[model samples]
Target: MKYSIRNILNSRSKANGNFFMEITKILGHKPKNTSIYKKAFTHRSMNIKDSEGNAINYERLEFLGDAMLSAVIASHLYLEVPSGDEGYLTKMRSKVVSREHLNELGKELNLLSLVESKIPSGQFGENIHGNLFEALVGAIFLDRGYKHCEKFIYKRVIIPYVDIETLEGKVISYKSLLIEWCQKEKKTFDYNVYEDTGNDDVRHFSVKLSIDEKVVSKARATSKKKAEEKASKRAFFAFQNRISQFK
Candidate 1:
């Protein structure tokens, strides 16, 4: 692959003094090991490799960050809602760390502005925001250990967003809600999804959500799962009153 001046400049920009300042602002303190943060924002598309020939990218860090987030959020839910049993606590934690929520957090911070990727930013999907957020958390854990990581999570995530009552009503998957309601009501539900090779390079899928042999809602998305979910959400809203009756 060829490298343009823009790509070269972008790589150099990651290490400049101003970049650290921007990071310090988000982290609420100066970072000791800036390279980890650099890794956090670096996308796998760059194909960077370490001296040991190990791939150097944010994916591993994202995994670590996800675990840390789960642990911290679980602890918070455990203490805050003493009466909640295992199932309730698990669901609450899932709501807090849901992809949509993390993506929103990353976007609110403008974290993607710091990312280094071979592909244009326009090509990246919404999940990139959450991926970067998780990688940043992992970098924090590596740079300053759990205490600093916890502090950053609380400041950025928990204190600002986590609310017990609000979270209780939050729906992580409208598809799950619709399925539960259907099962309870003894109604059959199905998502008929088909590949939609549109003009665009990205493959798409179209879905028709059927309830009791009647098509209730239809949607199209980049993936079958998403298409099904979009259709399910629409169907849920279409029958909102009926679905809510199960509550």
Candidate 2:
């Protein structure tokens, strides 16, 4: 069991080789710079730094990937739906790259398994999956350029999930929809949120959605946003016939 720098280098090379294969399968092409891909999955908790003493993590890549995703999706929607106006195109692109949809894509790829983090993966929030997926896109753009990045997005996002008719019907946020409807109908709506004690381990918030000074629906969730959204969904259904008429 004698150890040397050569043995350590060999071990690391073997690990990177396996990683390269995995990335290739995901990208549909070999990555030019494996180190960029490595940085994509490196969590801030690791406190990694480059030789220049600059912090290294996925956050920066996440921002870049978000922009890239938006640009590519917007371009696709623009060409695909020549009839769509600015608002329609914007909404369609949002649906295509929504947090929920991105999370699903990340889960499908199992990208979290590659993360280099000091924190346990289980402790991460649901957004971590989507974050990693975006970071991977940023890495692809940096390593292989926009052509490869656009191709990857088309394969993973546009080809499988994107359908003009389907996306038009998709609701990205019930809360936003509810609010818009309220405003359009000239109805004053309020979300009254308060902490709700529960036997479950997680703290909960209860929300009452009131429209026209009448309590329309009530719901509870671990977060106020979720609680309000749940209540809004219930309220939406409650007034579905009227809302449909407005639309």
Candidate 3:
């Protein structure tokens, strides 16, 4: 067979073209600077660097996107919930942009498929999906501006999921909820977390939630936070009757 150098280059060009189309569809507009979008999907493990020798990855964009989400959501809550006080508005915004919700958003968009990472995508934690989604939003803000970013947030987040009643009951932090309940009733609560690696290859943690020195619940998970949350959730259900009275 004859060597065809041009054929390989053409295939590469076509791949790039398709990637741009995918990004345009997601953003609802053509990206002005393709590099920014690329950076948004680039993982830190990839270890890319700019000509100035600065590390290039989605971390910075994630930070910007988090702020942008908070700002836009805060604005929407302010306007939509006219009677909501500072505490109410803040709580509403947190529910909307919580890590769990962001992870869902990222999964819905399948944003992880575009990430350039040295690590296998399967090995990544659930937060990576949300992290990349935030990076993409940050890229949009940088590439276009705040208006474009706000529009995307409205289309994907606010318009679809910002029902007042739904958000009011949504649990952003089960652990926080459990602690608050305990405090309200003048009960002391503690999360006794300890390492509990079993036969699994990954290390795990176990937690026992004690309320008033009584072990209310015990749970296990890959991380201390997850184990504590699991324990708290169990504890909450166990004390649901009493908690309802305080609520």
Task: Report the Cα lDDT for residue 174, model 1.
Answer: 79
Query: Could you give candidate 2's per-residue lDDT for residues 1-247 as a string of tens digits?
Result: 3223223235568777777899989987788877788889879997866656677789999999999999989988898899999999998888888999899789879998888789998899999999999999999999988977888887777765676755877677779998999999999999999999677678999998899999999988899999998888668756753212112
Per residue, candidate 3 scores C-alpha lDDT tens digits across 1-247 of 5322234224457756777898999987788987788788878897766656677889999999999999999988897789999999988888899999899789878898888779998899999989988998899899889988888888777765666765887677778887888889999988899999987799999998888998988988999989998788667756643212112
Q: Rate the local accuracy (lDDT) of all candidates.
A: 0.83, 0.83, 0.82
Which pairs in model 3 have colliding backbones? none
lDDT of 3: 0.82
Per-model TM-score, in order, reads 0.65, 0.65, 0.64
Report the C-alpha lDDT of model 1 over 1-247, residue by residue, as the tens digit. 4323234336567455677898999987788977788788888898877655677789999999999999888888888899999999999999899999899789878999988789999899999999999999999999899877887887777765676765898678879989999999999988899999688699999999999999998888899989888788667756643212112
- Better by lDDT, candidate 3 or 1: 1
Better of 2 and 3 by lDDT: 2
Model 2 ranges off by over 4 Å: 1-11, 170-247
Model 3, residue 169: C-alpha shift (Å): 1.7
TM-score of 2: 0.65
